[model samples]
Target: MRKKIIEFKNFNFKYRVQAEPTLKDINLTIYEGEKVLIVGPSGSGKSTLAHCLNGLVPFYYRGDMSGELKINEQDIRTKNIFELSKIVGTVLQDPDSQFIGLTVGEDIAFKLENYCVEQKKMKEKVEKSARLVDIDEELQSSPYRLSGGQKQRVTLAGVTVDDVKVLLFDEPLASLDPATGKGAMELIDNIQKQDNKTVVIIEHRLEDVLHCDVDRIVVMDNGCIICDTTPDELLSSNKLGVVGVREPLYITALRYAGCDINPEMSPKSVKTLNIENCKSKVKEWFEITTISEKQKKCDTILELQDVSFSYSQEKQILKDVSFKINKGDMVSIVGRNGAGKSTVSKLICGFYKPTSGKILFDGKDIETESIKSRSEKIGFVMQNPNQMISKTKVFDEVAFGLKIRGVDENQITERVHNVLKTCGLYGHRNWPISALSFGQKKRVTIAAILVLNPEVIILDEPTAGQDFKHYTEIMEFLIDLNKKGVTVIMVTHDMHLMLEYTNNVIVLSNGEKIADDSATNILTNNEIIQKANLKETSLHELAKKCNIDNSIEFVNKFIDYDRRVR
Candidate 1:
């Protein structure tokens, strides 16, 4: 029998800042060499459990706790975090929050230096670990200058350099593109297989980890384990979906079609699942009506002509980018990390002046306008929710933008309340910002911008860590706003969002505009998919396997049927 690496007995904890317990009576056992996933909505004690495993729960977090927590057959209460660090290495959810070194090389060696390793051996170990995570080439590069994907790699390398036997990842895939996230999972699998390491991954994105060869998945809610089962069983059961756990879109579609997902009747393998049936159901659910000729012929809102931008004299980030966003059009900008998707948003918001060519808003060049001046025309919601939040109360946060624009108190209150309810935050209007979860904060930031009712609304990574329920709500709200004559531009890596919500797609590669077309066209073009670091949707993949060449018809049928059944 494998060793029991982590054991929690009747454990309960409450943060010093709060009166209620975040975790309650958690009983769990993590065996050695087991890859366990702890999942739930934000603020569900997933991170709290991770902190407990790493000895940060009662130490750094200053929380009241009762009962026993053990790691590596040792009680964590008996040791400080520094002593427990030798047993478990943690890669935080936010890479930027844990960076301790100026360069990648130095950061990897930072942990080793604490042990007083000889300089020569330290160099060899640092190089080996850097190569392990594929960041060797970035050894001397400043960590601050690295892209989101590269920053994630640096954090992974930093955690593993100490040769810790237990590895804990707190949403490591949050900032990565899908391709990068998949690669990271493969690397993790390889490491566990070769080294027999115990891996505990905390993530809300279930699709990325579904195929990873994990031994067990422990689902958490309200600081307690709700479900503990294998990946195959978890995927086959609809219980997770009922509780709002965001399973893969394919699985969700299958469940909607009245397909029994039991061990014997479940689609079983993603490869073996009849994708045509699933797509037929998805199309039925979507009820995708063709755009009216008049709607398609709407007037242009913004035009980009021969726009080019370069960060340095030798390195150009964007080259000759050109596109047009029509009035009331919901457009998605998608690409790999660091592909200049965010740069296009900045240019649209007047944060950066294009090196050449013109960006015509209402057919007039606004290159000279400041970000503040352009706020009247465009509303920009940043990627990090923490950066956008400033006021203490939710109502005040949403009203700040309107107040700054010289709106009266009555108008501010009315607009704020309306936008709050639209974003599903009206219930928490009087609540302090500190009381909300990460997902709630995201909605708050969006609500603040949405209340402004700008001509064009631009959101950067609007649904990065949101759950399916929240994703649907946000997209539905945005769709309503678009119908009300607001142009929506979203910078996202979520393929599902692009396919199910947006009307147009813009693919970027190395900061260049590679393809601009409908979502259907982009999905079918293999070359564009490769360039933009995306794969065919699960529905598309399944359709090909079932020999359905007409994806449009398949999708329409699938969505229609799914809707009728629902």
Candidate 2:
């Protein structure tokens, strides 16, 4: 018989600031050695549940709680935060925020030091934990200086150092690239096997998390658990999309291709899915699907000519990179972390002067232009919302740029409100910035930039931590902006976003521009995908499995239809 490790019986919770409850009448049971995924749209109380497990609800958050919650058969009310920490180890979405030690080894040992473990044992445990996460060589390096993937591994090492029986991961894949995310998931899976640990992951990236074997998937909405079922059952149902959760891309493509999936088919089967059973159906659908012709390219709006940049003489970040952005184009800048993707955005935005090269904005050299001058023409939204948000209130934050330019109150109000509505934050316009969730704060920052109405917008991982609903909302709004003649440049690691929304793709690898072409073309080129460390979309694989003629064309048509319907 499986051991029940965590249980919630009719639990309810409400934050001190809110009038209504954030969690309502929840009943759940998680068995030992099980991997469970909790998924929901933004503001769905997923993070709140994680906080409860980590003893952050009543202790840190100061919330009113009722009913019973237990871990290892002990009631949560009987245990203090310090005691709970030994039972449940939490790794936050932002590893940087959780990091305390200056160096990697120090951070991993920080937790052990608090418990006053012997000096020899502490060093042994730290090294062992670091090796488990594949960060042994980075022991002497600063935790803040490591790559996104490495930082996450460091956090994992710290959490596992104590050998806790239950582990909680909050959005572990939010900031990682597809390849790196897969690696993280594999590491977690291995840890669970070796330690028989009960793992709970709260994330919006369902497809990536599903790569590992998941015992159950819990779907939540509006502070309620709507469904709890296995991965096979959950994907077979239509509830995921109805509740604003994103289904896997291949599943979406299968539905788009008019293939009636067998009710009993498991999503696990889809990983090595054999399409021979439905080949004819898929082929017929492809034959009938209308392929939309590509849109005409507009005039070049910005150009980078032989751009070469280096932070130091020993390390070059960009090597003779060159590209052109057309007016009203929705282009994606994609690559692995530290592959110079964000650096390209920085160079274009005038954050750094190229070591040797010239950047042209509307046929004029921007090398001599100041950042303030560049800001007037181009708007940049960073990946982390906290870095971009300034004002205390959502409305004020969105209106900060307009007010700085001496805009009248009436005009500022009109613009701010419209942008808020477009960004889906109109209801929270008057709310305090601190009251909002991470995703909501992200929208607020984007709204602040959109109100400025710059000709070009550059966003670094705009949908990094966003759920499906917010991702669609933000992308659709950006698409509308592109239709209005604003050139949109997205620096992202999400291949789905690149394939579905953007028309042009710029592939960067080790400070070099390897390919600049259509999204379909870039995705279809194995050489470019490998060089840039990009994962091919499942749709591409689906087409090949079905043996469809001109698989690229079929995938392209499916994307077109998907966009039109959405």
Candidate 3:
């Protein structure tokens, strides 16, 4: 039997500022050399549990604690963050915030320098760790200059340099594109195998994390551990949907096809998870499921023609990107991290002047329009909520957009109230923005834009790092808004959202437009999926294995059926 490295018994924790306990009566034990996955929705206390392990909960967070929490047989309450830092290293979800040095080499070596390590040894260790994470080549480059995936590697190298016994990854996939995220998972797995280290991952992206094998998966909700079991046992059960954590879409599809997943039937990869009656049941389900025809696009509410952009003369951000978004169409703009997906939206919002191109809103060129004027018709919610949130209080922040537009107090209050309620943020309406979690802050920013009621709303990575429940609420609200004649454009890295919610997708690669077609059409094309750094829905793979000629229609029909059943 492996040694016990982390143990939490009857543990409860409440932040100094929070009204109630964030973690309640939790009991979990992770053995040394074990890879455990902790999963939950936003505010579920998974991140809090991770903090407790890394000595951030009681130390940095200044939380009230009860019960016993021990790491390596030492009580955490007795140790400061520095003591625990040597035992467990943590890679936070946001790499930008984790950086502490001007360049990659300095950032990775910051901790060693603090410990007064010899310069020669520190250099050797930093280079070795960076090489392990495949980030050694960028040692002298500014950390901020690298792409999201590269930044992730730098952070990973930073943690490994200390050679901590246990590695804790909190939402590691939150920053990378799907293909890059897969590579990251493989890298972490390889390091663990090489060192025999204990690995604990806290993430909402369950399917992606499952790319590597895990010994156990611990599910949490409402500040409690709802289930602690192996992957086979958990996937075979319906607990994922009940706890509001997203199940692998392929698993969900299997259940929808009337073929329940059993313990023996479950596998880490969708390619190997074949059910006894899967083919027959799925084909029958497909036969009976009728996909509704797509509604005709009403008018050209927003159009970008021959758009080209560059920050410097030598580098191109977007090149000759042309696409038309109709009034009330829910569209997605997707690509890799540095593929300029967000830049396209910024140009549409008049944040950047195109090097040479045309942008028209309602049949007129928007070249002369001010950003403030463009925002009146089109609202943009940035990928990072912190970038947009200004007011300290929640209500003030949401109402700021409306008030500046000279709306009356009564109307502002009513509008803000409705938007907050729609966003599942009504309860946090009076709370300080700082007190909220990262995901909650995201909701507030969306609420701020939603309260203004723009004709077109463009959200960049809107559902990134959000829990499944909130993702559903926010996307459903967007759908409702679309039904009521609001056009929605999402710049996202989430493949599930792209396929399930958006009808049309615009693919970009190397600053050039690659494919502009229906989401189903684009997703089924392996060439486009690989080129865009996007992953194909398992539904597509299932169709091909089942000998279905048209994977596009299979994906489309299954999505329609899944939405109806849900």
lDDT of each: 0.81, 0.89, 0.89
- How far in Å is the alpha carbon of 108 misplaced in model 1? 0.9
Regions of model 2 farther than 4 Å from truth: none
As for model 2, its CA RMSD to the true structure in angstroms is 1.3
Model 1, position 364: C-alpha lDDT score: 86
Clash number for candidate 3 = 0
lDDT of 2: 0.89
lDDT winner between candidates 1 and 3: 3
In order of listing, the candidates' clash counts read 14, 0, 0
Worst 10 residues of 2 by lDDT: 262-271
Q: Give the per-residue Cα lDDT of candidate 2 at 310.
A: 95
lDDT of 1 by residue, 1-566 (tens): 78999999999999887789989999999988889888776567887888888888878889799988889888888899898888999987678878888888998888889999999999999998888878899999998889877888888788888889899998877777777777778888888887788999988778777646667778776667788887778888765766667777667656655555654434434654545434565444344533322257368999999899987889888989999999999999999988999888888888888888899998888988888989998999988889989999999999998888799999899989988887778889999998786678889999999998899999998887776667767888898899899999999877767877777899999988989887767877789888888766666665565455776555544444433443
Q: Which 10-residue window of candidate 1 scores lowest in summed lDDT?
A: 285-294
- TM-score of each model, paired residue for residue: 0.92, 0.98, 0.98
- For model 3, residues 91-164, the per-residue Cα lDDT tens digits are 98889999999999999999899899999999999999999999999999999999999999999889889899
Q: Candidate 3: give the clashing pairs.
A: none
